[model samples]
Target: MENVSTRRSGQALLVWGLLVVAANLRASLTGVGPLLDQVQADLGLVPAVAGLLNTLPLLTFAALSPLVPRLAARWGAERLLGGALMVLTLGIALRWVPVAAGLFTGTVLIGAGIAVGNVLLPSLIKRDFPTRVGMLTSAYATVMGGVAAVASGVAVPISEVAPGGWYTALGCWVLFALVAVLLWLPQMRAPRRAVQAVRGHRLPWGSGLAWAVTAFMGLQSLGFYVVVTWLPRFLQDNGTSAATAGWLLFLFQAVAVLTSLAVPGVMRRAGDQRVLAAICSAVMFLGYLGLLVAPGAAPLWSVVLGLGGGACLVLALAFIGLRAQDANVAGALSAMAQSIGYLLAAAGPVVFGLLHTVSAGWRVPIVVMCAAAAGQTIVALAAGGGTVRPATGEVPDRVPAPR
Candidate 1:
């Protein structure tokens, strides 16, 4: 009885540790947007360079994801995750140096750290809580979204009061990463042999289902990151105060948190998630259209976009697990999907910024967003309906292939 109780205690600690780590993944990145203007002024960043703050991370995620599985194979996911937390902590702290070089360098470090966590967490969930992937994915995603919302909401206020201003507000996230590192230490001692054994299967790059999943991941990320990068500026342009705009961003993320917690379980029981995907696409489209047509209804549009974006995220991650035959395949698929997906997503903010710069209006950029929504709806439908064939490594024709 004592042994069982002790094991349960350990398990509980692991879950908590994972949740804490998840919370840190996005807070550091999301916090930047709320204080972007301050950072730009302080660092003397050009608009093009300012856009790099968000784009660089997505580029890093694309570049690093395929390589992480190999690192996990050699070092074990737990040890790698702990190391990532350390890097994240260091990155967050480095931002306090108050120089343009320090800011960009820290952003790179933060992105690298997050890239590892982003790819590994789904695999970790598959390995540690195989039976509870949906529930745990939802839980961690919720925590991640919630903390991100809080980080966005509080960034300006924290900047206003912190001794080092925006830098201090950005650097403060190191505390969360530090705690995650400490809690994750115990996991580093876990046996690495299992991770090594599963490292042999090549990712099915040729599979159509794989590309569908990749496209779904990419389109959703493109939309989400564009919003994350620009929504505050959009609101501010329309005469909203910085604090109020920050809170609206928070509301957008908070609504996402709720939907992330609910969407996976709801979809898991359905025969196919294409309908859910359609609904999500519609919500996002309407939100964008609302923004274009009725700038005054920002609050309603924010919630609509948040719900859509969050549901799309849950579905994307869930598909990584649900479509795979085993954890190894899941990991491989995750790497491929994320690598391709994020690279594609990296263009979103840059392109959106360029469109606005060229046209001198939000209308053109928003029309692009609406087109992305339509494409996401179509891809999600295909991805949601496709199935993986373990024997030949092909996607069977349950869903029509994207032409």
Candidate 2:
């Protein structure tokens, strides 16, 4: 009885720790964009340099994600996560130094830590809660979205009264990171999983389905980041107040959070994700179209995007587990999807802005976003079946047509 009770306690702790992980995933990153002006003023940075501050983390994600699974294979997922949390804590504090070098360096560390967490969590869920992948994936996604939205909403307000303005607001995330580290201590001490199954020596790079999954992951991320980076400015440029535009962006994220909670229930009875994925893609396309066609209804379009984008995020994360045969494959697939996904997403904003600059209007850029969403649907249909595949180095031709 005592053993069973202890195990239950441990499982609960793990879930709590993962929720904390979800919280940490975006809070630190999201808070910065809102505080960018303050950071710019304090650091005496050029516009290009200030923009680099935001782009640095995604670049770190792109560079570091592919290496994390192998590290987790040797170090054990629990210990790796604990170490990542520690790094995140250090990065958060170092970012508070109010120095330009400190800011950039700390941001890199934060990304390195989060890159590990982002790849591991889905695989861990596959290992521990095999029967409940959809539920738990949505749970973490909801937590991530909610915390990110709140972080972005509160950053400016927090900086206004905090001792060091943006520095303090940025550093505030360390408190959560520390708590995650403390809670994760027990997981590291627990017996590690067999190392052979998840050696991650061979990612699913050769599989066609794997590529489809990666494309879905990348395209969804591309749309989301493009919207996140430009939505406020687009609103403001169209004659909205800065404060109102910020609130609209917050509403956009809030809707995503609320919509994420409903995804698991949809996944429960559905045999495959084909319809759901298609719906999400089409909805995002419409949202972008609405933005391009009628900027005055931006508020409504924001909510529509939140609904579609949030669901897309949950599906993208869940696809790692859903498409993989086991925890080992989940680990590898997660690595492949995110390494390429983030790299693609990191380039999205730059390309999105370039479109705007060359055309001298938002039309060309938004049309491109609409095109990306259309592309997302093609990959979604390709990857949406419930078929699970192994980590073999070849593509399967027997995949069922999407219903």
Candidate 3:
């Protein structure tokens, strides 16, 4: 009985730790948009250079994601995660150095740290909570979205009172990362077994279903980042104040938090997720169309788009676990999907900004977003049809061997 109770207590701690990590992952990035204008003015950056601030992280995500699995294989996931948290802390702190070099350098470190967490967390969920993936995924996703919303909403206010202004607001995320690191420290002491490599078994890089899942992940991420990067500016352009635009962006993320919390369980039970995918796509399409046609109804469109974006994100993450055969494969597939997906997504904000610069309007960029939504719908249908392959074996639940 004591052993069982202790195990349960440990599990609970792990769950909370995971949630805290998830919360920090996006807060650092999403907080930037709300303070973007101020940062631009402070740094004397044009729109394209400002857009690169958002794009650079995605590029880092693309570049670093593939390497994380190997790092996990070597260092153990728990230790790697703890190390990543430390890096994230350093990165966020670097932004406060009050130089353009400091800002971009810190952003690069932040992206690299987040890239490891992004690829590893789902795999960790699969490995540690095999029977409760949907519930736990939903929980962490909810926390991630909710924290991101709060970060976006309060960024301007925080900057106003913070001594270093936008730099302080951006750098404050290190506190959250530091807390996560402390919470996660207990995990490093727990035993973990190394995942054995399967002989003659290569990852399904060419599988059609794998490609579908990758595409779905990419398109959904592309749409979400584009909004996170530009939604505040969009609202501000349509007669909303900067503070109001920040709250509206918060509304967008808050709605997503609700949807993300609810969607995973529904997806788990449904015979096929295609219907859900179709519904998500429709909501996104209408939301974008509404944004283009009726800037006056910004609040309504933000909710609609948030619902769609949130649902799509949950579905994409769930697919990463549900489609894999085991935690090891899940990690590999996650690396592949995110590597490709984020590379595809990295172009979104930069391209959106460049188009806005050349065309002198938001319409063309939005239309491109709508087209990405269409692509997402098509891929989600394919990905939702069924699982691609069963995991060969479960990764043993023990502390990974020392490097």
Query: Which ranges of candidate 2 are over 4 A from the true structure?
Result: 195-197, 386-388, 393-403
Note the Cα lDDT for every prediction shown: 0.82, 0.86, 0.82
TM-score of predicted structure 2 = 0.95
- Residues 1-403, candidate 2, lDDT per residue (tens digit)? 9999998998899899899888899899888888898799878999888988678888888888888778986888888888998999999999889899889889999999999898899888887777788889999999999999999999999999989888999998889889888888888888886532245646888788889889999999888888888999999998999999999999999999999999989988788888899899999999999999999999999999998999999999988888887777777888889989999999999999998989998999999889999999888887887444665563332222222
Considering TM-score, where higher is better, how would the candidates rank from best to worst?
2, 1, 3
Candidate 2 residue 380 Cα shift, in angstroms, is: 1.0
Number of the top lDDT candidate? 2
Local error of candidate 3 at residue 220 (angstroms) = 0.8
lDDT of 1 at 366: 99
Q: Write the per-residue lDDT of candidate 3 for residues 1-403, one digit (tens) a residue.
A: 9999999999999999999999888889888876778989989999778877888889999998878777887778888888998999999999988889999999999998899899888888877787677778788888988888888778888999989999999998888889999999999877765542211123457668878989989988888888887888899899999778877878888899999878866876787678898789778988998998898999899999999999988878877777766677677778878999999888887788789989999999999888888878877778876554533443433323110
| Runs with alpha carbons beyond 4 Å of true place in candidate 1 | 1-7, 193-198, 389-403
Candidate 1 whole-model C-alpha lDDT, 0 to 1: 0.82
Compute each candidate's TM-score over C-alphas.
0.92, 0.95, 0.91
TM-score (C-alpha) between model 1 and the true structure:
0.92
Which 10 consecutive residues of model 2 have the lowest summed lDDT? 394-403
